[model samples]
Target: MPLLNNENKIPCYIQNQLIHDKDIKSIVFVNSHLPADETLLVKSITLVKRITTVSVVNNFTKELNLNSVDISHIFIFLDNINDIPSASSAIANQEVFSLNNPKYYFLFIKPTDNSRDEIKNILDQVWKCHELWKYVLVFCMETEWLRIVSYNPFKQLLVEFQSDCNNTTMFSNMLKNVNGYRIKTIFFYTLKSSKMENGKCRGNDCEVMETFFNYINATNEEVVLNVTEDLLYPVSQDYIKQDRADVMFNNMFLYIELYKYSAFAFAHSNVYAVVPRASTLTFLTNIIFMFTPIVWIGIGIIPLIYYHLLSIFDNYAIGKHHVRGILISKYVYALIFTCIFQSMIITTLTSPKYRKNIETLHDLFESNLSIYGVKDWMYMFHREVAIRYKPWNNTSITSALNNLTLDGAYIVGEYWLNLFLKNKTRIGGTYNDYYYKIKEAVGTGLLTYYTRRNSPYREIIYKITLLRNMAGLDKEFGYREINFTKALKSKSLTLIHLQSSFVFLSVGWILSTLVFSIEVITNIILQHIKTK
Candidate 1:
């Protein structure tokens, strides 16, 4: 028998420690990294578990034969399989266990703090053999453990762990004594003020730990807090409330500044909880009032003077022949009237102030306006109206109009407005007409165009009007009642014919107006010469 030498510091237990148990169910092989001898050791241990082991291969599988044994579990140990032959051969051996119907778990062991490039290379190999079941890669460094858990085909897997020592204690004790806390403590201690300077507690080293402990104690309720390396110092619950209050204050100030100038804001602040709606006409009128001084200076004064001068010149040349008379006749009257009419039309059509007053019928469909129209119209154009259209063939235009009147549908500019009003009384007439009621609602600003709240083209309208005024186009023309009537009839005919009626009507109106004016002028001149 060999004598045990106690003087040489060799004990029976120390000698036995070097020997690994062959019957061990789970084996943890410790080494600086996987070596050739270690691979043999792993293979021998796996053989006892009745699993075949194959060497890494470059091109072909080098199969190892083992007596058929019942394998229930398998754990693959690997570092980096840089050698293609060894890796391929090892995977080929793992395939045998699969045929043996063993439940397998592959464990890839790597030294921790791997760079992104190294991690990518490792993942490339792992993904290639992902068909194998139950795989886990563990990166072990003294400071941190990077674990890549399994992901199924359809779902993504995310692993979140708490960084706080107190919160993490419930899961794993290993994290509680991590090196992060030691590094943080060391950093705080090295601060310049961390050392006392006049018997006063100096630096941030005062009661940070105590305060943190208190915070942990306060959170008695179960709450999952996700931690990263950056979140080493946990925030206190009291500080979170202060942060929320600060955010609220900032938002309130921002909104208040936004609403400071307009009547909309004034009403919201002082008059009522919400602003009232107004008719298109009334809304535009108020907008004109808001910028009254500018209007008076820009177009009102100069246009009035110009119109008066033109009228004086036309009166002086009233007796001229047809061509000269046509050129000079009614020049002043036309100019003045044109100035006023054009001003109104331009303001109404292009101004941002007026846009809010009258929205397109489509706008009503899209808004919260309780309108009803045909389903086809709703499908095609109701998005612009902001209204809901209900399809009902049995519903007549008269009945629909009546319902709208009763419900006080403020604005009804739909395609069927004329058809709906054909049999209804005028606004002031009997039958409690819906159109009048709607008009009243609009006047009171109860139901108005949704677009009126914010003028989408306000700036563009202002710019265009400014341009028109600068170009001296601010003039109005009086409505020619007889000619307008004829024109209206011709326009109606064009609508009925749906052909080139507009061109025919335009030519006819111009010819008719010239002939009528010439006849009148010739008769007046003959009468004057006969009297003389």
Candidate 2:
């Protein structure tokens, strides 16, 4: 596509810089009617460079279809600065530019529109649509000496340079050399030693902040949050902003997911619940559960097999009548026991007859259990059932934590779920004895953090998050898998499986009875002799 004319050839240096990042597969050139000279330049660049490009002509006549276009880097050539506002508004509605990333933009302004006020005006017009002019480079040349400017993520720092070499080397150098930018992060405390949690932060927050500052190199500005849900929560975006915090531990733990922050996803969170252990069934129910009907029916078939065996043994064993009877009885007993044992083992191991707890979304809503969790956690994940139950107060929270409220299930993140188990065990001296997470997850929970917009440390934090997530954020962030793990085959072991133990116990009883008889007979004989 002939975009620019032959008279004005694009510098090779710019072409090399534009294709620097290997991540960018295709470049989008959005321009309107070009002059004869510029059109020839575009033709030469397009053919010689061999860089993949998507040409979208904006003649101000009709809407362009950018829906299919996967635009990463944008080359916008603007002749008139006044046309920028309308162009920005039009592009903002399109999916290609909806995110307002501010990066991936290289503005080629005409010399006439290159002024301090014009640049400020252009920024003002786009301000409502965009947050910060991050990674944006604007350039206009007057003969050989090049005039270029770069803006950082905050958009507060304006770096202008007049150099012969028009490359992005300055931008890279500026990013590293930039200093005096501090980040103040306010995080919610998971556990509080004092009754009142508001005054100062302690416990888990201290440990978390230590690891946080190590990666981010930021100071902690502690903020305590108390919600009606009575569950521990991270700080709100607005609250942290009001407190003048440069960064924050937002969208973490149980906070409602906000999509406003720049894309730096760190965690895969799900709405897991602390459900009552389903093994706590009644005696009658337990007895019924023990008989997990195997493929070959244990009860009915075993008796018939024993009968057949007894008949076979009677005929097969060649001995005296009493001896044959004893041998047949013993053989029948052993055969019947073995058949029952095999069936029960297979049945119980394959499918343990279980008392159904809340395992699915349908099961959860239908269940009578009062769900206790963060308000947003309940509302977002289980709105149907969440409406039925009220948020837990402090009193209810204490009781629920101690396994006092058996009917109530607490919804929590997999990370916090482990913490809950640890806390319970610390107090009660039991690990997973009282509560267990259900098989079905309510929702996926993300362990993402939202920094105060335009915070300098935001980029560093994002990079750290990327590395941590790639290495498994769940384990990297100290989430214990042992807490949530359940062994189905072994855990499903029930009372009826102990029948063999009872058989041995019965044999011990018979032996003890024989010993008692021998002792009594010996004592009686001794007494009779003494009397005589």
Candidate 3:
């Protein structure tokens, strides 16, 4: 409803019209200060009675000033075929055309009193501007001769098609006879798969493909794209990097970047473990002394030998009635107690704290847990967290979270991670606790089809995208609500049960081995004294 101009002021009288009128639109009339009689054609059109004027100065070198005006539609009047090129050039020089809004052009021309040769000249000029100013409507001053211009709906289109080789040449073959600007393709090439084979284009074989063979030649088909630079296909970059042609060809109008709630998910509202350097070293040292193959074998053998000695003591005490048998039994019981005490100490040191919870970046930075994430996500994570972590590769992030050596959470985009959550069993966590949304969002990205700079089809694509969004067609293309607070109700039983069991088993093994060593040393001393 608001109009922008060089002087950032809105007229008071128009304010009511803007408020009262349910529909609001902006139309601009571009001209060279023509006479009142010549402007009669534009005035006759009731739809654009309140058009804002952007008059071109007499000095042809200087461009027209359209500063601060938000123009949605432009009306250009061509008095004659001779004025076509100059008028088109002046319209091109305006800054309003470069905005992120839709633009429409209406061409109003005066009837020429010239021969057929002059009419052909007029058509030539119109065709020249057709490629530049798309979505154009041509009007004649004399209504009787207006039928002379045969209007084909497809005449103003410039299509840059994208499709997989599987679609073959069907799309192009369908639009062969459609009158319009030339259509180009945006193809991608990788080392393993390309649009070309053995220095020849694959699309050159089919009838429709043959028509565009030269345009999409082998050299042209092979292109390196930087999709991540725009964050357009953040979740689907892996697919686009390899086979985006198929994705674009199937989806028509309004290519949307999915807003996924899971992208911001990090572990929160749960207790996180922080493994210190000292505890890791101490734990590893205990494991080494306890799990040695020889020591482990002795633990099993020594337990059997102790049972045999108890039987011998029972027989010796009954036969000889000796008090020495009771003394030996007491000594073995003390050794078992010593082993049990050592195992308990190891378990206590390794037990992680589960009381403190992390909810913000400040808490995460202050905590001792090391952050680990995928290699490709390093740039995005580095922008948020201070700690540097070695990038993980070809591994599931949830599976890696089980490692007590790392922080329990990681950063992943919505596409890959969300798919992973939907299909895989919750091995390391429950559905409710899969991911926690961070307090601050790094940023959001828009997904757009990659095309050549100054592509003629850009305007047409923009219009299609806008129309689709208005009609709610983007929902069909995998759009979903991003509820950050929502979580799954069920929890995984295996993950919770195994986390503590692994630690207990490790501590028990070390304790039994220490007891076995004492039994071997005691036996050696008894033999030495008997030999003496």
* Candidate with best TM-score: 2
The number of clashing residue pairs in each candidate reads 32, 15, 2
Model 2 Cα shift for residue 169 (angstroms): 3.7
TM-score of each: 0.19, 0.51, 0.34
Model 3: residues with Cα > 4 Å off, grouped in runs? 1-24, 35-72, 77-95, 98-130, 133-182, 189-441, 450-532
In order of TM-score, best first, we have 2, 3, 1
Give the Å error, residue 250, model 2: 5.8
* Residue range 1-532, candidate 3, lDDT tens digits: 1112212111111222233333335544554244443244334333344544333233334545556355544445445546656655554444355341323333334445655455445545544443233333333433322212212223433232222112112112222244433343334322111236686644311212333333222112322345632232332344332333212211111222211111111111111212222335555555444334653564456566556644644543233222333334435544554565466445433322211224344444444345555454344343645254555553444445433233445554443333334443345543324333343232222334433221233434444445444663455344332234422221112223233433443343334334444445666787799999
**Model 1 weakest lDDT span, ten residues long:** 265-274
lDDT of 1 by residue, 372-403 (tens): 43332232232433334444332453344444
Least well predicted 10-residue stretch by lDDT in candidate 2: 1-10
Arranged by lDDT with the best first, the candidates are 2, 3, 1
Best by lDDT: 2
Query: What is the alpha-carbon lDDT of model 2 when measured against the actual structure?
Result: 0.50
For each candidate in the order shown, give its overall lDDT on alpha carbons: 0.31, 0.50, 0.37
Candidate 1 local lDDT, residue 236: 19
**How big is the RMSD of model 1?**
28.2
In candidate 3, how many Å is residue 28 off? 2.6
Query: What TM-score would you give candidate 3 relative to the actual structure?
Result: 0.34
